[model samples]
Target chain A: MPMSPEAQALLKAARKHPDRPSDEARTRMRRNVMRAVSAGAGAVGATTAGTAAAQTLFAKIAGGALVVAALGGVVVGGRALFSSSESSVDPKNAPASTSTSTTVVGTSRETSEALGSTSTAANLDPTSDRVVASSALRTTATPSASSVASSPRIATAPSKPAEANITSDAASAPAVESVDVLKEEAALLASAQSALGKGQAARALELTNEHETRFPKGALSFERRAVHAMALCALGRGTEGRREAQAIVDRAPGTPLAERVSAACP
Target chain B: MPTPNALRSVNAPSAAGGVIPVAATRGSRSTTPPKTFDDLYDDHVDLVWRALRRFGVSEPGLEDAVQEVFIVAFKKLDTFEGKSALSTWLYGIAAYVARNVRRSQRRRPETPTEDAGLHLTSASDSPEDEVGAAEALRVLHALLDELDDDKREVFVLAELEGLTAPEISTSLGVNVNTIYARLRAARAAFEQAVVRRRAKDARQLQKGGLPCR
Candidate 1:
């Protein structure tokens, strides 16, 4: 099954020379992601806002850090979780800041602009252990529904805009409702998978039940069933898990899901 | 226990190579908390971009696809309970977006353009090197296109992106044994594809078709 030398060479060369965006595109997309977050395009609530604010700041700091490192010839350290910035300028020891609430000094307007905004750096949140992006310093401070509609980039909105809880006419439309159902199904399945991965089989089963209640004939029924079977195996219900896995394998042979199911109980 | 070699090879050919220090950006998830959205984007944008391209998101639609992945990421960030590496989690999201983009593009096919392959060349690359790399990329994509979705994904994630079997399993929600099995099958299929393409090209040359170069 090993690739021939020529095929291997091609892959090695391609890997060595993978495509990437120009720095400009990277910055523009970063700004767009931030804009999307600020506009509350995905979901709405206190939790969403807090996470978005923190993310916005992280993007800013990351952008600034890259520019500084490039100019200073500082080989920024790997993804280490360092709390203090004692080695900020020293490339030899500097790790890219993943700290939620480190105070960044000498953040310039150029860096801000390069990151796709013209806003000044905001105060680091001292109260929270995580870095909280200041909402007041957001480039688009007043992110209204009207503004979200006006911007072409933001127009696409989150693929799951229904999660945003917007009760407008658009949200009530039948077509939009269908898409939201799928998105919610996916979200529930993802949470279930996360739970399974975390060894919370009972919790995973509960989420699956919630999914069944919300979406009995959901688009992701197959995926949900697979997760359910796996959870059953995890909880030591080998006979039931095997039966479920076998049903899926018989239905769809040679698929990843089939492979997963076969192995889940074996 | 194949570890996803988080970092790119140090001996990469050129500065224009634009190699991503994936490990440098994709922080170890061993003890680190779930990454902030900014951290996730900054750390793995290149990885996501490359994945989308390999996943068949055309260059024109590539940016939108990338945006969609992160927006989905933003919405689902809380669900990321640090079960898998950040890169793998993003890959899962990118895979979903890429599939959707490909599906939509299929419904509205665009006119094929001459500049179809990934634009990996940099200002630093010599014209000869640029041509070579571009052609190699073109051939690579052509071979990949022959693969079915499942095999293609396995090949792209394992061979092209350098994710380990376990990481791909976590991202894909497949069994690790299945991943290894698929990787083996994919490599063999890809080699056959290369051989078939070369044989066909040779036949064309013998029939006095244009030179490959």
Candidate 2:
């Protein structure tokens, strides 16, 4: 069919139909695009960043704590079980360096002095490592994790020697109410995961921070850290994300969480 | 756009891979690389958005759909060989994304273009023409909504967006002859619908209403 004049006029009008997006819309679109671009753009560098961020942030945060299962799937600060040699990798000594590669659990003499206890003094209480860890912390440190003292789940933690045994009991809690507790905490974790999956890294960060604040000694601390690292990397904070993820791997080497962290960070 | 001898050249990757590659166009006049995705967005967002609007995506979801197209294009940046005009590649993405938006949106029928939105009115247009254009577009889109998806798409692309039959074929993944056939049928259907709408508008005008349905 030949194009009618009326069709021509209408088509012209239709072709002019799209309004330029409002400045607000344009700004919003740009912000989202930039975020995605930076996120995806960073994906190439993510492995390195995730490891660096995990390693750096984890050590700085963990302080001198040896990674104990009782410390909510991560070591916060504690005595060095290692030999009397001064920390081979002291963060304090190499303050000039930006690399967190040297952040060892009790590597720095400062970390050892900061923690200042023999491994025997701060032994892991399979049932209450938080109790022991907190008892041995710097005065500036926060109280034994609120997550531990409050949640009834900790009360029943068996005096099992193995960290796995502590984790296993928490996972397979027998009481009906404890399952509800676990479910509630799991839902919070899921929300953070959902945000990350939806590409809302900022929202995911908020959720992860909230998760940490609300459940400091929660069982899914490692899981939360995983998502947190991923979100940071997705936000283009590669160095930090790598450090966080690498920390999980370093502290809990040979464990499932460490394996997952290693895979994700790499 | 003609397909290059190979799917991709190491020097000139497609848009799917990353940024737009440099094209040696305006030969000897330019040394710069080809336009980036941001450049592409600045050039074509309006075209994609308008086409999407005509293709049944409501205004509320328009921005997201637009962003999705660019995001896809950005990812597929390296895949964008100079095989087709950048616009064509973008249109292909926009159409598919808008269709997906439409598919999900069809469940709860919302007509932002019709109800609250008096879209397509221009500042230069006389108040009467502005209102008239809006009513005309409403009838146009309403009529457009009635045709089957195939006819509607062809009509929207060929008439409204003015994509050539070959471009339409490439963008829509249909044969060139099929586009011709569809465009022919679509135009006929469109003419018939316009006649019906004008007659309905006359009838409504005779009833003394200020605006035509």
Candidate 3:
């Protein structure tokens, strides 16, 4: 069958109808892409600063070689203590002894201050500390109860008193632990950024996944997710990446991070 | 229409390849490089909108579908090997996106016609003429709705979107003969539906003592 004259006329009329998207929509989309790129860059900056601050603090506290030597001493001391009579102590009685030790250690104000600083630093810089702690803890701590119960208390005892004294001494003390975490996060972000910049999207995606698993609550978590979305986009998984980006935006609204997510998702 | 220079060029022997003449050879020189997904949207937005209008997609729905098509194209651009013209490739994407949009709308029982309103022909004409044109377009849309999806897609691509049959075939991944057959069937179905609509409208106009023209 050939086309009827009326149907042809109708099609011609339909073709004559105009339908382009508005200027505003195009502008919004461009803005979204730009925002995602910016957020990834910003996360990298914050992480780098935090990493530098943490390394400086670590150097000042341990004095490099002495800190390494002290760590070796602690490991040897731990093994000896674990083999001693303390290994036979009942599990239920351990907390009481540990608390008592902490109290004794806290009696010295200087020791308390040092411990407080270290704890604060750990919390602030959890990214590096987390990696370091996981690896260090896995290697040094014997699974035996005596080693787990007594070692941390004894090791932290001297620093606890110093930390206690400095509680009020540095009211304005920057959160060193958070900074370290930020630095580690920044390094991950930088690696992802570099990979993405070079169009190695699959590598960026792999790095993002590793970062997320290792540092689920790391400061750069949201930013890492956004980068992951970008990697997805590059890989031609736009719909999936869009959904992930939307999730990031919903979870972290109003932050610079959210803006980045929306940008990528959009 | 062949110029003397064109004939001479065709006759001239190639320095490198003895059998093939330089000018007569296909794929010898690039026209425009194939458009990327981003390039497609940036270049043919107007064409996309026109295609959407033919499918009777509402303004907002059209916007969403257009964006979806381009986004999908962006993700899948690596697969596009410049085998077909960019416009043909894009039309296929737009058709797929529009069909999805229509299917989703069907599940909700909302009237796309009511939502779309009579605004398509309402802008440039007198109120009475706008109403007539809108009413005519509505009838045309009803007729289009009667055709099967494949036929309707071919019809829209060829008649409404003004693509050549070969272009439609390439975009649709069908043989040229299939496009021709679908276009013929689509046109016949559309014509029958339009005649029925016009007859019904005439009867109502006469019953109400209104002018039928």
Give the top-scoring candidate (lDDT). Answer: 1
Instruction: State which candidate, 1 or 2, has the greater DockQ.
Output: 1
- Quantify all predictions' global Cα lDDT against the true fold: 0.50, 0.46, 0.43
lDDT (Cα, tens digit) per residue for candidate 3, span A67-176 = 22111211111221122212222232121121111221111222222222222222211111111111111111122211222111111111122223223222332222
Q: Which whole-number lDDT from 0 to 100 does residue B101 have in model 1?
A: 58
lDDT of 3 by residue, B26-69 (tens): 12123443322233345666666667556645554554345444
Instruction: Judge candidate 1 against the unseen true structure and give its global Cα lDDT, from 0 to 1.
Output: 0.50
Off by over 4 Å in 1: A46-266, B1-35, B113-128, B209-213
lDDT tens digits, residues A148-215, model 1? 22111122211122222222222233322332343345456656766776789999889888987887
Classified by CAPRI criteria, candidate 1 counts as incorrect
User: What is the per-residue lDDT of model 2 for residues B1-213, given as tens digits with 9 covering 90 to 100?
Assistant: 223222123234221233322222211123234444445565666777777777776555666556556545544443455556666666676666666556656744443545333222221123235555555466567667667667877788777766788987877777899989988888788778666655655565577643422
What lDDT is reached at residue A58 by model 2?
A: 21
Q: What is the C-alpha lDDT profile of model 1 across B53-129, one tens digit per residue?
A: 89877666666557656655654443454456777877877776666556655655355753332222221122236
What lDDT is obtained when candidate 3 is compared to the true structure? 0.43
Q: In candidate 2, what are the lDDT values of residues A1-266, reduced to their tens digit?
A: 66555555555555555345665555445433432332222221111132443332122222222121112111111122111101211222112122212233322322222222212223223333222221111111112222122111111111122223223443233222322233334445556666776688889889889988876655445556767887788888888989997865555455444554456456
